[model samples]
Target: MRTLHWFRNDLRLQDNPALLAACQQGEVLPVFILDTDEPVRSALGGASRAWLHQSLTALDASLNNNLVMLKGSAQTLIPDLCARYQIEAVTWNRGYEPWTIQRDSGLKAALKANGLSVTSYNGALLFEPWDTVKKDGYPYRVYTPFYKHCMANLATRTPGVLNTARIQMVPHGEQAGLESLALRPKVAWDEAMLMDWTPGEQGAQGRLQHFLATGMGDYREGRDFPAKRSVSGLSAHLHFGEISPHQILASVRAESPADDNQTHFIKELVWREFSYNLLYHFPTLQEKNLQAKFDHFPWETDETFLKAWQTGQTGYPIVDAGMRELRQTGSMHNRVRMIVASFLIKNLKLHWHHGERWFWDCLVDADLASNSASWQWCAGSGADAAPYFRIFNPITQGQRFDPDGAYTRRYVPELKRMPSKYLYEPWACPVEISRAAGVVIGKDYPAPIVEVKASREAALAAFSEMKRRAES
Candidate 1:
């Protein structure tokens, strides 16, 4: 019996339901098809492209270098491979994104019509997006009830074990090797990401173990502080399906009782689930406002401001630091992600999609659901979104989270010499103090792009006007 396992988001061998099911039947041939044709399936951002190349390389190495890689639309490539390999059954993990769900559904129908068996399993998320819903059977718009429903309803399953010794490897037949994908950036822009991240199952497992050993202790208190280095940093791994959320949950449960810190970490995972729910319910989330009133809210676009924000020259230390960290490491602290996102959407009053697009291109952990939902949350145009008036004041956010300036200084080297007192609000320092710090505002460090108080008020007024117009 020959079975084909199609690898999509779920990249790892162990604990992968689809892969394990395929292995159970007979000889397992693992195949990965790069689908980039559909309109909803946009081109991979530069950072994600780079990470994918490394991840695929690592995955092939793990598969004893027998993993078959193909390029083109999965609709054509999948049937072609099945015919070429004389495969009888095909199995794969489900991708919950709207585009993926549609694509996979059509492929499964086509494959089954040809007398080949097709099976799809939940490999990425703890529960399928369609499984959880409100009492009336409508999808959840708010996260609280959705998370509570999931917790009470969804039972945790033990991670699956893979017996690689019993597995038979199919020979790679006319497959495009990892290098043929050209996922790496043409220019040398990823030196720091290369140093900071390891992209496969080994790297993912190592990161999880290290976080459990060291960072988990202070995760609750220090997670909000960018300088603490207490975050699990498992986001990219999660996004790439190098590791499953179940594995992380099981590891935490096995380590100790669910303490406050452990519970908080679990909440964060649930947040990811909530984002998927939003994406599943709202297919046009990435392109339009979830809250329809935001459609009428006037948003100004300044290319100069957008460029400054993108390049980490926003003149606000914390915002710049977060952006620079994103540029350097292909990741940013969660707290800083919120702060910078708020600065962009509220302070600049540009559309949230602009910020969403930039993060999609930059962050290694960028997922269609999470990125879109998060930007909407920050902009107050999402389901269960923050109130539009709750604009984040970057300086206060910095002083609160990045106090002692360690995180800011580490990323924004220009502010390395400033005093801790004047770290966040560098413009407030005396001329003599600025001179002593060897930094001149508006020259070495640019002044604030927009005044915080004024921007907040302007954002509030705009939101109010939009609300009024909607009511009328």
Candidate 2:
């Protein structure tokens, strides 16, 4: 019997249950569909597209150049390929995003109706959304209880190791290759991202090894500081299925099972699972506010402020640094992500979706579930979100997180010579100090776009008004 292995988010060959299962049955035809036109899932943004191009290239090479690449909707293409190749079964790993789950369900039903066996395995997440639930069968909404439950019942089952020796590849049908998909950007602005990442399984493994050796020891103390080399930087790799969460967890458990840092890393992995769970239970997560009261919250939609925020010209060092880093590297530190998000939603009084959309376009690790959930968390519009009145002070956030001006200096070069006292708030510098630093507040670097004290007060007043309106 011939089987077709459909690769979606689970892009790698190792530790992939569906790919492994397909290989075991009979001759396996490995295929990937570039569903650029799918209405259910939004089109891949430029950074994601660039990463996809590289990832697909690496995947094809790993398959001995036999991976069949096709472009179109998976619904019609899978059946057409089966008909053409006389495929006996179709197998793939599952996806948790609302549209993908719906698409997979319809495809499974259609294939089964035609007498073709369909198998969907969990390859992306450590546990499927439905695996862990409350006694009444509903999913947990709060992170603390949800994480505790997951930790208590955490399975030690490691990801399956693929037997490459037994693998056999089927000849390509309706031949195409990675370049045919046109995933790369037409104008070419990815030099920094190219320097920063290697988008494949090998790169993911290398990142894990480096983190364990150097970064994991101080992950707890240093993760909040953007200048420190404390983060895993494996987000894009994880998002593209280059690395499995189980593999990451197992690696940590083996090296430092008793260490607090290792435990914290595991909690972060569990957080990823938690976001997927939220999206699974609340299918409208990306489209609507999870907290209904937030539906009445007023949002100022100003393009000028939005553009300034996007371009890293917000006149706030920490905010600008994070935005500039995102544009150049296609990723940003976790702590910076929160600070910048707070500035956008609360300080500027913009809707969370605007920032969410911008990140969706700019971030290489822009996951639908995490991006939406985090934005809502900042906007106080999510389940278990931070309160709306808890506005972040951009100046202090920079001072606290990027102390000594190292992070701000690296990304916002104009502030390279500014003193630590005025690094985050250059407008506070006296004329002599600004001159000595070879920087002018309004000329060389922008003054603070919105004053921190006044903006915080305005944001609180707006929040109060939103509550009043919602109650009325």
Candidate 3:
């Protein structure tokens, strides 16, 4: 019997469930499609596209002689490939986005009509979003209990790791040759992006090793600091499913088992699972607020203000630095993400959707679950969101998270010469210090677009009105 392993987000040969199953079941042809209609590629920015190319290259190397690259949607391409190759079954790890659901469902129907067997597995997330549920059989909206449930009852299933030496079932593979398939990215690959990130399965494994050996123990303390390479720089890999959560969990369980850091790291992964579950259950959370009361609150649609925020000229050093980092590297520190998101949604009263879309385009690891939930969380319109009145003080946030302002210095080079106090709010520096930094307030780096004290008051009043109406 012939089998096809259709690769999607899951890009690894090691610990890959679908690939392992395909190997075990029969002769296997491994394939990936450069679908122009794929949401990831269609919206992928410079960094993401570059990373995708590298990851595909790595996957091809790992598979040795067994992989093929294809173009066209799997819905259209796979059935034809299956028919042409005389394949009996097509299998893959599932995808989660709303758009992906429509794509996969159509592919399943098409393959079935072509008289081929179609099977899929949950390998993308540690816990498939739908499987985790409250005791009452409903999905949990708040994160803590949801996290607790996930942590308390995470499945012990091991990821399918390939021992290529044990390959007794190598395929007499049939594929539309690479030239005919036309599977290259449309975006020009950015060499700078490649410098900042390592892509693919081996890269993911190396990152996890570094994190466990040096960073994982201090991850809680160091993850908040963008200046330090404290957090595992594996988000892009995880986003693309190069490393499964199960592999991460199993490795942690095997090595550190019962250590507080392992426990903490596991919970963070669970939080990611919870975010997925929240997205799965509340599919409209991307476009509509999870908290319906937020629906009544008005938001500004000011393009000028948004353009400043996007370009990192918002005049708030921390927010600007975070945005600048994103512009340069296609990723931002997690803490700063909250600070800037809150600055836009609450301080400036801009619609969360605008910032969300920009991040969607900019971040290499831009996850639908995390990005969507995080924006709404800051906006106080999502599950377990910050309270409406709990607006971030950009100056205080800069002082707290980036106490020495090293991260600020890296991205906002204009502030590198200023003192630590001035670094957090460089505009507060004397004219002489600003001059020393070669920054002329409004010219070099723009002055604060909105005064923090005034903006805080304005946001508080808006939120207060929202609460009053809700209470009434």
Candidate 4:
């Protein structure tokens, strides 16, 4: 019997349950479909598409160039492929996004109705979102209980299978190549990204091993400092399913002794799971505020400020650094991500949607669930969100996290010569010091876009008005 394995997020051959299942049966046909018509939030951003192009290339090579690439609606294409190839069964790893869920459901039904055996496996997440819920059977609305619950009931997973030797490729004539998908950027903007990342299973495994050996020891404290190498840097790899969470978890548990750093890393992984849980339970997570009270909040519509924020001209060094890093490297440090997001939503009084959309386009790890949930969390409009009043002070955040200014200066090179005392707040540098440093605030580097203290007061006032209006 011929089986078809539709590759979605699970891009790797190692530890891919659905792919393994397909191989176990008979000759397997591996296929990938690029459905560009997905909803705006679900669609692949430019950075993500570029990464996808590389990832698919790597996956095709791993399959001995047997991977088939298709474009257009999967609803129409999968059945056609199955019919053409005389495939008796179809298999795939599950997707958690709302659009994918709906699409997969319809496609599954259509395939089964046509007398094709279809099976979907939980390959993306360690545990299905529905598996861990409140005792009352409702979904979790907070992180602590969910984490405690997950930790208390940690389940053992079967080891990832390597079935390459058994995977007999179903021979077919040449189809469209990976380049025909047009996933790479049309311009030359991706040079830095190419230098920064290796998008494949081997790369993901190498990253995980390197992090375990070096980064995991100090991950808890050093992860916040952007200059430190404590981060795993596996987010883009994970986003593309080049590696599995189970693989990471198993490695962490086996290789390292239990410690605060290890625990913190595991908790961070759980946070990803939590984001997926929220997305799964609340389908409108991408579009609407999970907390309805935010609907009454006064959000500003200032294109100039939004554009400034997008271009890293906000004049706040740390925030600008983060944004610039995103544009340059297709990734940003996590701590800086929160600082930049807070500056955008609270200080600028812009809607979180603006930041969300921007990150969706720029981040190599631009996941639908995590991106939406994180932006809303920063805006204080999401599940377990920071309180609206708890705004981040970008200046203090910079001094605290990037104290030596190494991380900030690397991206915001205009302020490279500024004194450490005045690095984060270049606008405050004395005239003599500014001249000595060969930097002029408002000329070479922008002045602070909005006064932080005044913006905090204005944001509080707006939040108060929103509360009053919501109550009334």
Q: How high is the CA lDDT of each candidate model?
A: 0.89, 0.87, 0.80, 0.92
Order the candidates by lDDT, highest first. 4, 1, 2, 3
Write model 1 residue lDDT over 1-472, tens digit each, in one string.
Answer: 7899999888898899999998899898899888866564455688988888889989988888889887788899889888988989999998877778888899999999999999999888987888888888899999899989988975677999899778787665565788777788888687668688899888999999999999999999989998999999999999989999999989987885578898889989999999998899888888889989888897888888898899999889999999999989999999999999999988998888889889999889889999999999989999999998888899999999988899999999988999999999899999998988889999999998999999889988888888888888
Greater lDDT among 3 and 4 belongs to 4
Q: Report the number of the highest-lDDT candidate.
A: 4
Candidate 4 residue spans exceeding 4 A from truth: none
What is candidate 3's TM-score against the reference? 0.92
**Evaluation by TM-score, superior candidate among 2 and 3:** 2
Per residue, candidate 4 scores C-alpha lDDT tens digits across 1-472 of 7999999998999989999899989999999999866876679989898889889999999999999998888899899999999999999999999989999999999999999999999888877999989999999989999999889877657557875876899988757979779888778688777686889999999999999999999999999999996999989998999999998889999998799998999999899999999999999999999999999999999999999999999999999999999998899999999999999999999999999999999988999999999998988899999999999999999999999999999999998899999998898899999989999888999988899999999999999999999999
lDDT of 3 at 433: 73
- Residue pairs with clashing backbones, model 1: none
Candidate RMSDs in Å, in order, are 1.2, 1.2, 2.6, 0.9
The sequence of per-residue lDDT tens digits that candidate 2 reaches over residues 1-472 is 7999998877788889999999989889999998754663456778888888888888888888888888988899899999888899999989888778888999899999999999999988887899868889998888998898899988767778888768877666456778788888777887657687888888889999999988998999989998897989988989999988888888888876468898888889988888899999998888799988888887888898999999999999999999999999899899999999999999999999898888988899889888888899999998779998888888889989888888889999998988888898788889899989999978999877788888888889889888898899
Q: How accurate is candidate 4 locally (lDDT)?
A: 0.92
Candidate 3, residues 163-264: lDDT per residue as tens digits?
776653335445554545433345544566467677889899988898888887777678887777677777889988889988888887776647666767
Tell me which of candidates 2 and 4 scores higher on TM-score: 4
